[model samples]
Target: MRRLADASAPERRKWYARGAFFHAEDLHYLKFLIGEGARVLELGCGTGELLAALRPRYGVGVDFSAGMIGEAHKAHPHLTFLVGDIEDEAFIRQLPGPFDVILVVDTLGAVDDCQGMFENLHALCARETRLIVGYFSHLWYPALKAAETLGLKMPQPAQNILSPADVGSLVALADFEAVKSERRLLLPARVFGLGRLFNRFIAPLPLVSSLCLRHYTVCRSLRHRSADVRSASIVVPARNERGNIEPAVQRIPRFVEDLEIVFVEGHSQDGTWAEIERVRAVYPHYDIKAVKQPGKGKSDAVFAGFEVARGDVLIILDADLTVPPEQMPKFWEAIRSGKGEFVNGSRLVYPLEVQAMRFLNLIANKIFSILFTWLLSQRFTDTLCGSKALRRSDYARLKAARGYFGEFDPFGDFELIFGASKLGLKAVEIPIRYASRTYGQTQISRFRHGVMLLRMVVFAFLRIKAM
Candidate 1:
């Protein structure tokens, strides 16, 4: 308690943000913390430098140091700055919250007890909130000790080093699951230009270079506290399948407490939107909406619908009815139970309905799934099933990771699948009954879609499997 109280005293934190390179790395870490427009509360924010760097929609920085709080306020007037102890629940609760991210940087070493500190921070966040924790790595102790002796590193003793395993175990006890971890550097200022180039191209590669100096972990709360959880938004893209919209909605057994059906009318020349709007009137009691496609294809329609979805969980439901809507619970339950971060409905495993898939399509699916699974070491039975569920938060993260893959996919499957792989998400497939589309026509030109799918498989193999 004394350590927590004194660690961030005004006098101690005044000198915290003097280094430019260190500040840049801290900003880089913040980019990983939250999506743009996310709410944030940074606990034990010394000089509130990190809070200032992140610039979230609602940024709040709390510190024990009155000096740090004052400095934080001056630098980021838009953010609410408070003087408080993170270890004190009453104090923590006083600060406004329900933040999307709870950030703690470099303060972990100062806390008297990591477990107690994490518990309090976890209580201040939303269920979908992510915890971004970063610390000086234990392996760097020798180098830091030497640097401190020569006045190169921060002047502090032994700095309460915790191993990666210890940190993981503590996070679990705090009821927050660790999703990812990695090392990054705060390059010295002497070679600023060269350092930028290294980080941009060279340093990110696994083979070349320095690690074990810094560690960052991305975490999610295991417990949820929302009083009234929002309904899952299910986005369905209908093309020529005008006949199937009614059954899809009718058979969509409401697994979630609240549900909204978003139908993206993919420029179907066969009056798919007309049928959708007709079905909409029938379900006026149910929350349903019809959105015209922003672009011509199913992928474009899905992306457009995802843009406006307002739900705790976002789901993609195929308009073809190939995967039954009743089985949606499987995907939802999988994510809720933490069985996997992504739950994809699989039709290849089951004896798909007679004439459901042409032999060529079946073979293509099997071949593509095998290549992707083998390449990523992530199992995938059916690649084209078109039913997947994840929270809106998860989807945002995937979109950010999409920078690694480029906008290479026209179908949007690779975008999600590859992001899940890169983020280290557990990708599991759920078998479902595949029913043939009862509609105007099949929009897929198998040869073209197959070629695209093959290209994606190869690309994923190089990016994820190689990594």
Candidate 2:
């Protein structure tokens, strides 16, 4: 412990001397996971620069080095700094707890017992608390060692050299589940014009991203207890889905608790609005509401229905009925089990019904899935699937942060998925068989929409991946 403290004593000044590109990049990614005004506690916090930058409502930083803690106090008096070993259970218990976000940046390697550090973190976290850990990638071991030898980086004590999988196992052992993980910072030092472009754009690409400098893991407490059955709202966005309205109303299964069906009719040449009214009257026993969409696009229509929905859980179901309404129970069950915070339906997992999707559309879906998996740092098999479910509270946060991507998404799928990723929410895909539509023609224009989707991908790269 004395040797560890001595090694990190000069780090605060050394970090500023050596261009802090990795530090800046790490803070950028962490800020996305932890929104503004969160209660944050950072372990092994050296100088507390990252904690100060996050602007948490309440911030506490702990370091094994008394010198580091003293420098942190002098640098950022607004936040509390303490000298304590994170692996010590008694020391961890003394710190203020129930933090919304707990950060461990690059210091896990220096810890004596990595698993003990994770176990101690549990005392500071709540059910909703998120634990974010960032560490140097073993792939960059030679480069980092060379930098340290050349005095370009601060010298450190011998590291535990844990991989992302190792850290994940330790977190699971400590009663937390891994939500998401990714590699970042391909260029740790500025290289003039190419630095921003390479690190932000090129580094996040599928095959290329694996060679980055650091790995970050986001984890949440494992909920062994089941969630209670809550009221639900299913929002159906109709734009030429007149023929499926009555069938949709009849097919939707009853929920254990309250269930309301909301129909948002967009501008359609067919009498979709009339069909919605007809279904509402026919299914008077069921809770149903109809409204004319004030704006264009499926995103606008979905938002309109969601605005009027009154349920604890909110869901989006395309009126085409390609994903059967019967699958709602499976989605509800996943959320009710506390297995996932965001439930996405995957059509690509199971074999699709004949003529359910065009060959070109199928290929496009597969391609986009690969792109999004890299972009969002989460496994996404089908990004265009029209069925998705989430808690109303989560939707509100997503809606508030929608401006980050702007109103570019017409499909409404990307907005939800992107927002969930930004919030570090656990997204689980529910596999469902895709069936051929029995009613109206497909509203999607294959070539035109495909081009738009490609543009959205680039937009996401700039907004999400590059960030």
Candidate 3:
């Protein structure tokens, strides 16, 4: 296989060009998964196209074919490319450690020992690092073989035909957890633009997704946390919730050693700003900060609070106090213990308090949860929950890459949820006993928000599922 690849290296660019549409779609999904200026490493990098396209702060490509590495160096001199067999333990040991994202795109089939290759990657990952392994789905074997015979696709050496289950099993054997798995690109050719429609819409549908030509499995290291104690910043977005101000602060337990509370007032007419000031003064012993949002929506308020926040972890705690502050420890522990990267509150898990949620709202939450679960390729029990938690570093990365989704989210929940999904952060739900608001009327206009949510569903479909 090495000799074959080395012999074919010079013609690799022509082969990829012949399949331009498919190659471009593959790169598009990769760019969506990986943020620009990340530290990236790619194995089996043919001509280094995938690595260079990522525009990483530090990019490295490794391939067994010397010819491929030569072409890669000539094309992308900025990136580091090496000619070495990834299957060799000694060769793997010499490479750098701790890349932000590691990619094995379309090359896993040639691997002789998949489990050993994955095990070797352990040293190349940090606790937060994500490993993406993309390959042709086993179901596409017949179609790919026919394409190769018909000269429509690049000919290949004999390789392993692995299913998602096979990849998941290998990942577990290597002591890594598969966070999410997705099937994509049903039609590999542009047949009068019908391929785009099939790939963007029909391909993502429930049963039809099984027919996708490519599959991606996202994995994360299960290593222990580097530090035992981490600080937290809980951002409370208050809007006309004056009566719940002090209680919100008072109920919060100091779960972490260092905790800071930030209250962002969103132009509330009911003296919410005055109440925030009062709470800041009253909670002198507690680290508290208050700020007025420059814009109107909750998303704006959350971002404003994030700017002033100074903690290792950032959390969104609603000022309405529906999701009790006492349940915050679960979120902190989830991140601290490496259980999940993005912690979301799930009000639908445990029984809600009487009058806590309306029937229509409850039905909508369930429907959106299913939709998001499918859209993200990660299970989400509740999508509209106001409380969410993530590391400040992860939040920084998400904020930097927010342009892909834009500022389309008004309620602030979907923004974080979407960003977390795009960044490949493991989403975990902590069941919370949602309670009825005690002090303020509900600010959400059901019909207006419903229409907006429908629009967001379409937006997410385009940005997420359709790529």
Q: Best-fitting candidate, measured by TM-score?
A: 3
Candidates 1 and 3 compared: the better one by TM-score is 3
For model 2, residues 1-467, the per-residue Cα lDDT tens digits are 55666567656667655667767777787887888998999988888888999999999999878888888888899999998888899999888898989998878887877777787777777656888988888878888888889988876656777778888898888878899888788888788866667888778777787898878899987743245547999999999999999999889999755999999999888999888888888879999999999999888998898899988788888999999999998888888888988999999988889999999998999999999987887899999999999888778988888888877777888988988888888889999999999989988877887888888898988888887
Query: What does the lDDT come to for candidate 3?
Result: 0.89
Compose the digit string of candidate 3's lDDT tens values, residues 212-308: 9989999987753342447999999999999999998889999987999999999999999998888788779999999999998888999999999
Candidates sorted by TM-score, best first: 3, 2, 1
Displacement of the residue 368 alpha carbon in candidate 1, Å: 9.0
Q: Give every collision pair in model 3.
A: none
- lDDT rank order: 3, 2, 1
Estimate every model's Cα lDDT from 0 to 1. Answer: 0.73, 0.85, 0.89
Q: Which ten residues in a row have the lowest lDDT in candidate 1?
A: 203-212
Name the runs in model 3 displaced over 4 angstroms.
224-229
Off by over 4 Å in 1: 1-18, 35-38, 65-84, 186-194, 202-212, 225-227, 230-233, 242-250, 254-262, 269-291, 303-314, 332-385, 390-409, 414-467
Off by over 4 Å in 2: 3-11, 224-229
> TM-score of every model?
0.72, 0.92, 0.96
lDDT of 3 at 371: 91
